[model samples]
Target: MEQQKFEKMYLMQTVQKTIVILRAFTKEQPKLSLTELNKKTGIGLSSLQRFVATLVYEGFLIRDDRTKQYQLGLSLIHLGKLVEEESSIITIAQPILQQLNKATKESISMSIIDGNERRCIMNIESSYALSARNHVGDTSPLYAGASAKSLLAFLPQEEIDQYLDEVAMEHVTENTVVDREQLLEQLQEIRKQQYVFTRAERIIGACSFSTAIISNGRPVASIAIIIPEARFDEEQFDELRELILHAKFDIEKQLNK
Candidate 1:
């Protein structure tokens, strides 16, 4: 009975309950009815109704007048726009990404390590049909991609060892380096060059290049570009490298203000 009261009290926290409701809708399930949301979230109908009422009032949620189906509202778009505008790095890098797209016609992406996973913060759509679009909230492994390696290279060896002990490399692909020695060697190269590049390391036909976005002598995040392995050329790297460096500097400069 005491545990039940404690759990119920904690569940009353608005932010915590909101996430439980909202996260139920994903790319596959983009909308849900009140009953469905309550079922999926396992919250009582009465309690869920009250929470939904608050969300609807706050404009974080909306209901269809005809069907009465509930979904995320325009307020989320407003909040997202505000986040994009307020983020120093994203604000500065947006135009730079545009300029890069014009110059290379390839997709560029930015990623940050969040605990044990990597989160893509910003990305530009690729013009080519063969190119892929990495979404902003997409999560990837910290040992799987060039951007992940760039982050690992910047972190201390002790930290890396501690992480490796838990993540025991399971091969995501035939090309992924599972051997600790080889991965350490790659990290060393990234540390020396301030960048990481891999051909078909994460995906069989895809290649990527990543660089650390450093501010105040520390890597705050990583920036990367993905290109088809068949399309990669050493000569093209020079132009892309310059553009990426400029973008990194612009983002860091915004931190000064």
Candidate 2:
């Protein structure tokens, strides 16, 4: 236990040092040499060298060979743009998602693709005492769940193929589809119908209806309504489907603008 604690503390200190080095560059000093960075961060030259080299290798910093000065890199700009887009998406979708939650009294969510997983970026919980609860930042494999499959289904064919080729599908629940061929067929149907319905795939006793939010003829995210299986009504399915589809349409219209 003592050794583990010491190792963890050491790792954290190393991380703090890295942050300090990155923070040393600012608007007033957008680029810095190794000596300047050491002075600004109070880290020794040898340690600073290792940290800066790692940052440059990871594309978080770039060094000009001629000037021997380092500046923040393009990767930081890409990450900043991603954060901006996610913030914009949540801002644009929240009101519509609230309306959908009010109309159906069910959990409503917006999800986006994050590498090999689907991550919920926005969620409004159901109003009922017994509800299907999924919070923001919840993640599941791309091959499972209505929300996840809907996002996967809308990706370009090449991406879909690459994902299937690389990821090993494992069943999350008894109802989860782990067979690639069956999953492909389901994706085909989802594309043709423009919506996905699933039951107990990720969480037992939960059913979800999902559709993609598209911009510029490509899917940027997905919207889902989750409800308890006990309360699922076939008679009300059409109404619920229409509500989610309308939400998708409204969000997409605003996003495209």
TM-score of each: 0.65, 0.93
Tens-place lDDT digits, model 1, residues 101-143: 7777888888877778778888888888888556799887788
Provide the lDDT at 142 for model 1: 81
Off by over 4 Å in 2: 216-218
Clash count list over all predictions = 0, 0
Cα RMSDs, all models? 12.3, 1.7
Cα lDDT listed for each candidate: 0.80, 0.93
Maximum-lDDT candidate: 2
Best by TM-score: 2
State the displacement of the C-alpha of residue 214, model 1, in Å, after optimal TM-score superposition: 1.2
Candidate 2 lands at a TM-score of: 0.93
Which residue pairs in model 2 clash with each other?
none
